[model samples]
Target chain A: MSYIMLSYTDLLLASLLLMINGVLSVIFSLGLLKRLVIAVTRMVVQLLLVGSILSWLFAAPSPFWTLLAAFVMVAFAGYEIVSRQDRPLKGFWSAGLGAGSMTVASMVIVLLALTTQIRPDPWYHPQYMIPILGMILGNTMTGVSLGLNTLTNAVRREAGAIEAGLILGMSRHKAMQGVIRQSLRNGLMPLINAMSVMGLVSLPGMMTGQILAGAAPQEAVKYQILIMFLISGATGFGVIISVLGASLRLSDNRHRLRLDRLASGNGK
Target chain B: MLEIVNLHRPGLSPVSLRIDDGECLALMGPSGSGKSLILRAVADLDPNEGRVRANGDERSQTPAPLWRQKVGFLPAQPGWWGESVGDHIEKSDSVLDLLHKLHLPDESLNWPVSRLSTGETQRLALIRLLAHAPKVLLLDEPTSALDEEARKSVEALLKAQLSNGVSILLTTHDKKQANRLCQRIFHINKGVVTEAFS
Candidate 1:
């Protein structure tokens, strides 16, 4: 193996890879060409901004600024996730709980387990915490959105059964048991599928990134396993807490459903 | 008795109707004649510009869910959401008796709702409604899906349940069933309810 110095050529090569991916995406005509273009453009702009800010922060590292940036990322991601769904964005508490809990839990685990001994600064290291927290928050956003969508649809479709349960002296929680179960199952299925097929079928992003950065294959694999476990656990917690919190918001003090609040897209 | 005042659709005159307790009031009308709307209004399922008083109590005084539980409203088609038949039917003494009256077998409790036929599901839906012991049963084409024999059995079941101080407001296009089942008949034409048969 030979070590090569980083050069402008490397940036050109990365741009070429992006172009090839774009061409292949167009050739496939996957009906997501518009979305792909928008995603790539946004990713480029966001990374450029992040890189510039991070370069400065790393040079003159401020712990408070780094932590604030991570919080902003979580909050922005939470808003985007909730707004993307069919439901209205009246319930911010659930979104906050989901994003804050998962981001904090996973970031703490990554910091304490892997980098605490290795890195000089632990609490708010821009190089370590920003990237790790970003990954965790992104995953949590997906989990929360999926959970909320499934739950809202389930409740809407099963209104009659829920009403029947209410008539039978059952509380709202008891009435919504089936809907809650089905929604949680639907929300968790994607993460479960991903975890089941991991390692053998796919090289996860973290492992691939490490290998490209000249880390040993074994070291990268260990990090990938740890991160995957952390992500899956965080996602589970996020989905469960978000669903429960959102369900509570749907009901009133008397346990009657205030369905008007959760109504989708301009109630008729 | 159930009294409906100012029960009017948009761009139509208000209607008033009063039926005594234990009376079977059959509402007959063509499609889109506001027959089902009347039933929904009584059940408090629809927001309408009117007042409905059931058993001497104004609807506004009673909670909507409590009102709905007392006023059992059956739409043309049953709305099913549970997985198994037993899942939908809560434990009650009258549940098995109502199931038997509707000609459903004891084994129906174990069957999945997906396995139920349209007629069986309709019967089961009626049984489920009656199991709650609603004071007023509002049916919109309750037996429209059934054959002659099933309709007869359901009619008989409704008649049997009338002794328990239950008031039924049934809607149907079948004149013979209406004549056989109702003590009073209200015809809805051009968005107005008129007493046509008694």
Candidate 2:
């Protein structure tokens, strides 16, 4: 069976289904109509731009272009992490800690996988590199940002306890070990919950997309399993690095809690 | 003995003072006059510009953890991180003795920290710091929340610590308590230190 293609008319018909959401907003006075329009418009514009870029990459693949794309993706991921934080760190740390860890984890994990598991003709082929890197960076960004958010908030909340421990001769690492562990948990919780209900409750996104594009169900499932494991590894690595790095930034060489480094207010 | 020379932190003026071995120096100031910041700076808890010496040895010579071990600063509300009060307080023989002296029962250690009254929290905070056997004690309003009887026990406990050669820097609003307990009272206003010879 051949896969069906959507024309402009078909796309417009599908958008009609979304009208129910606007109706509900109006009936309930939820004030979501404005946001709903903004979100949908933004998604269409962004996805179309990405699609055009992907087509161009496929037409002419090169290592430099691939690297540039990867860098841009990670940069945006870092910016998003900073934006999502309720209380971002002061100065360069607002972007440095999360983005640095995410770039390291996603790049290393993707390189390792492309070379060993899913080797295309040229390992850096845009066909393979772009999609894989995009997936890995997206998931890792969520994990890292969530981890950093939790880490910053916890460090602020536990400033007193940390000082108590420090005054008792405990090192900064020892004082913050508990907060780091909890932060890692918060970062990885979404991935864990998704994996726990993978096939039954929710089909993995990559697998659903692959199956729709006419890949065999078995092939899609196999790739889905691999993708799931890869996402988990990347997310786990990113979360640990980001959380530990953020914790270190919250304290100083004197083992004292540097609460001034944090932006004011209890985080959302 | 702890000597702080030209101790300066942000929002506080320069402070220089000395407390000899077994001496209790009372720090009296209005609210928000940086009394707590002075205590914190002396403890090396905040980044500051100053020279703090314990027993004539520079504090910066030692590692931060070890430095903190020798000089303890108890905040107005001591932060308790553990579920039970005992988790933060090591129950050594001296710790038990201090708790008893502060009128906190041995059973109170097992109680969750949320169960402690303000006076109990203050007393327990002192006991926790005393467990370190610090050479210099920076107490921020150590008896502010206590009643007359409890305040007397706390003062008695501090006297015992002082006799054992512990140098104390105390902040209090109680003038009579300062006159009674402190050898010299130093009033801090706008971070300027003036010796009040009573």
Candidate 3:
């Protein structure tokens, strides 16, 4: 089966759908017209940029370009996580630690998947490496952001109860056990729900793309399952690293909570 | 068996005091006199420029959780976590006697904390503190939410703890209750600490 490529005219015709939605947004007084326009515009620009970069990357297939792109993706992801945090860590710590953990965990997972399972002709093959890294980093970034936001808010709201635990001869780890558990649950819940209702409720983007590219249903399903598993593991690892790091950073050695380092009360 | 050295805060003056084993010291002050802040500082729950020694061990030298364990703090409006009361308390036979002493039935342990009244929560919080067998207990109006009878019962329960050599520092607006329980009374107004003339 051959994959059908879209022409520039085909893309232009499809873009009109966004204009129709933007018009409706204004007519309905939803006040989402500005956001809709910006989102659509940004999506087009970002995808075009990524498309150009990938074309160049796949042509050369250099380890340097692949690593550099991966780094940028993770850096952007880290920035997103920090910005989304209600009580973001001070100065560079928020972005630094957040990006560092997500990059390390997502890269390791993607690398292992590539080397052992996919086994691309070259281990650092840009075709497989860049997209895989982007997917893992993107999903993991969302998880880390959700977990950190929930954790910081929970710690603040339940300050009295947490202090009570500490006063009751509990170690810091023990005192924060409930909050940590809740944060992890919050992080993973969306993915878990999606996994549970995947095929019946909605065809996921990857599977839909694969089908559109003329892949057999069975083959597309297999690839989608693998992608789902990879995403789940990456999300868990990202949340664990971020929440643990944030928790430690926000507490003193004496197990005292110091939320003063937070820049804002509400996560953006 | 607890000593506070030069405990200073913005509103509260540099205050120093000591309570021997089996003794209760009361801090009496008007609202907003920084009494609760003083108790919080002694418990190391709040950051303050002060030194607290529990049985000659400095608070700074000890880890916060361990120090707090030794010097337990019960706030005025106690915080309760866990769905059921039993979830917070350790499962022990001694807890039954404690619940009994505090006028709470054994079945109350299994009851949800959400169902507990303000007075019940207050007693249960006091019982929870005593359950830890802390050497020094810092209480903030432990009886404020209780009725006259419940207040007496809580005072009696505290007396039992005192007999076991637990040192206590408490805050109260009720002079009679302070006189009844505390051997020494300190007055605070606008954060200045002074000993009452008895």
Candidate 4:
């Protein structure tokens, strides 16, 4: 049995349900009413744009278009991570390093999964590769942002501790070992927690999406597990790369912390 | 010998002084007089417009990490990281005997850094500093937290290090300790320096 498709009227009715939430926010004076409305509007607009692009790409099924869409997604993911940092690196280094690391890590993981495990017909099949790459990149971006945030803020706060280590003959990398380790752990915590709570507490988004689209439960479960493994691995790798790259940028060859290279305020 | 040529920071004047081998020079000053700032500058931990040299070797001639290792600066309130006291001390075997000299037991190495008292942490930090056998020791109130007995032991250990041809630059608020341990004393007030005696 295939999933029922939502028509324009059905979507309109579903959107009306959001009015109840808006009314409640207004009645309770939550101060989030405006933000809620703007956010919902943005969600609809952005999803429509992406949906339109995906429809066109799916119909054509060209390797070029598939790669282009993937690149765009990764670019936006990188930008999101950079904009989320509190003490982000200065100028292009902030966006460049973050995007570079995530792109390298996620692309490598997704390609490895596609070429080795999935092995779909034509090898660059849009249907298989796009969603897989999207899931991996989306999750990896969050992890990288967490790692970057933790590293920068922790280094600033623990400057004394790190300086102490540097004064003791440690190389710059060696001096930052403690903070880097903490940051990486923090970056991976969400993925680890999700893995722990899978199926027990709540069904994951990917699994639910698959089930709603009319895939068999067992098949959906299998795909969900595979994607989870991909995401976990990608996030772990991406976070490490981002943290190391960012930390290197923060220090100099003489093992001194050059905090001036970082901008003052956190990014929004 | 240690030489400071026109060392200037925000609050510190262009202070210049020389500390000969096996000599201990004390820096006495009121609070916020940039005493520790001078020490940090000399150690290459802060940005300053000046020069520092040890035994005719300028700090700029060497890398910052190497310079810092050679010219160790112990802050007033020591900064400790890692799980245990032992983790900070490199080449533990060579420095194992020095622990007893500072009244620290062998098992103290296994104790968590969180478990250490302020005095103990200071002493351990001193030992950690000595592990590198820096040619010049820039100490910022190393014994400020110690009691009379612990202070005596630390002073004795420092004096021994001095006797072995190490140059020392130390800061203290206590005039007695300065007179007792320092061969020369320089008083700093409002970022200006005046030599009391040599």
Candidate 2 residues lying further than 4 Å off, grouped into runs, are: A265-268
Question: Fraction of true contacts kept, per model?
Answer: 0.16, 0.68, 0.56, 0.58
RMSD of 1: 5.5
TM-score of chain B of 3: 0.96
Candidate 4 residue pairs in clash (backbone atoms < 3 Å): A86-A266
Per-prediction TM-score: 0.73, 0.96, 0.91, 0.83
Best by lDDT: 2
* CAPRI level of candidate 4: medium
> What is the descending lDDT order?
2, 4, 3, 1
Q: Which candidate tops DockQ?
A: 2
* DockQ, computed on Cα atoms, for candidate 3: 0.58
Ranking by DockQ: 2, 3, 4, 1
DockQ score of each predicted structure, in the order shown: 0.19, 0.71, 0.58, 0.53
Model 3 lDDT per residue over A1-268, tens place: 6798999999999988887888888888989998888998899999999999999999988988898988788778887888888777778777876777788779888988899888997899998898778778888888888888888888888877877787676777888888889988998888899899999998988888889989998998998898788888888888898888877776767776667766664434
> Which parts of model 1 have CA positions greater than 4 angstroms off?
A1-5, A14-42, A61-68, A82-128, A155-172, A193-234, A245-268, B1-19, B44-68, B90-100, B103-111, B186-198
Per-residue alpha-carbon lDDT of model 1 for B61-130, expressed as tens digits?
8766677777787877676657888877875667877777777778787789888898888898888788
* lDDT at position B92, candidate 4: 66
Give the per-residue lDDT of model 1 (tens digit) for A11-64: 767867776667777888756667767987899789889989889878776878
Worst 10 residues of 3 chain A by lDDT: A259-268
